[model samples]
Target: MNDALPREIHAVLIPVGSVRLLLPNAIVAEIAPLSGLEKVERAPAWLLGRMPWRDDTIPLVSFSLLTDANAQEDVRTARVAVLKTLADDDEMPHIGLLAHGLPRLITITPDLLVRTDGGERLARGTSAHVLVRSDQAIIPDLHWIEARIAQALPA
Candidate 1:
């Protein structure tokens, strides 16, 4: 047996628009149906709005719009991925992402993951473009996203 082989990482492939977001399963709190998004005035287009979840209302964002300004917000068959924020602040402990479809669970091994050249400029909210097996996905910058969300929220 190869004892030195890297352990496998259980992850999720979340469909945003044309691209997929590769994220660890731990950060994903829940996958809920898209509903009751209260639009916020003077907010950026990328900030979809706010959605009700449990006893709290969390900000929802369109990953596609964040990366590409021209990307349209497709609501048909849309779902909200409630993600646990990386930060320890209580004001914004969780944020939601508008997903085009249900996320698929994937097991990631070091050998199966490959770094790919996304382009001359990587999109906002994305840390790296990678290919997991045959699927091409982007690793999201959760900290950056959380900061942006925190700034956007009305103080």
Candidate 2:
């Protein structure tokens, strides 16, 4: 008789501004150095722009600008974490997040994740602000963010 292997959940902790964005590792396509993008006219500051990747173009969402309406963007030192859209739309399959630093891969388990007060009062797009081994981190709502991105796409 064969037994099924135990499943393990992995996530990446991406640094964006002063916060750490927690995202499931499976959703992340690749971590690339920040590059120039085509700006979306009339878009909010939170909507950074669109960056080209592979054979397709992916829009970059500014995590910093989203959290704080007052955004002072400093992209010169940032990186981009290309993510697979959870929206399941072929028109926009991928999106990028402006990450401040390199992402760190970590194993996610019950013992490591603990709910904290940081994210409780924040608005949507954040699943929760948790303490991973006592270090504060924000769990991003990929679906929610992706949905917003879809709406913000230039018509």
Candidate 3:
């Protein structure tokens, strides 16, 4: 591993249904529960809508559908993992990810990470890894997830 990268990354591990995911701490701006989410009409099913964050309103992508899981019906309280994505001109911008519950922050070392294979048991754009007693996975790039969601939206 290059010295440029941190030997250990402070990651936020979140449990979504049965699987847990590790999110890079750098990109995470804040974790906030859903409040006044405005639904976007004709948007993709995975897209819950836009929510106010500070002075901006960013789109929210459901991690469930992003993993090709069945749409959850009873999500009264959602934890939004606010992330920054580079715009077309290389400007860092914010977006929110709608997850099921709270996110636990932990420091993860490279030696502790194990590659995983979800195979046909899962869908595309989903990744897995082994961390301690459980299998952890993460969507490495939120922009790609957002792009997938954007692509799926009707024109």
Q: How does model 1 fare in lDDT? A: 0.90
**TM-scores, each model vs. reference:** 0.92, 0.89, 0.79
lDDT against the true structure, per candidate, is 0.90, 0.83, 0.68
Model 2 lDDT tens row, 19-71: 89888899999998777688998777788888888898889989878767776
Candidate 2 positional error at 5, Å: 13
lDDT score, candidate 3, position 45:
75
Candidate 3 structure quality by residue, lDDT tens digits, 1-155: 56587787887877654556677888789988788788888877777788888988777877766666675734576678888775552322677777677788877777777666534343555645455435556544455675775565445
Error in Å for residue 59 of model 3? 0.5
Candidate 3 wrongly placed segments (more than 4 Å): 1-4, 86-92, 118-122, 132-135, 152-155
Model 2 spans with C-alpha error above 4 angstroms: 1-7
Q: How much does candidate 2 score in TM-score?
A: 0.89
Clashing pairs in 2: none
Compared with the true structure, the alpha-carbon lDDT of candidate 2 equals 0.83
**Clash totals, every prediction:** 0, 0, 0
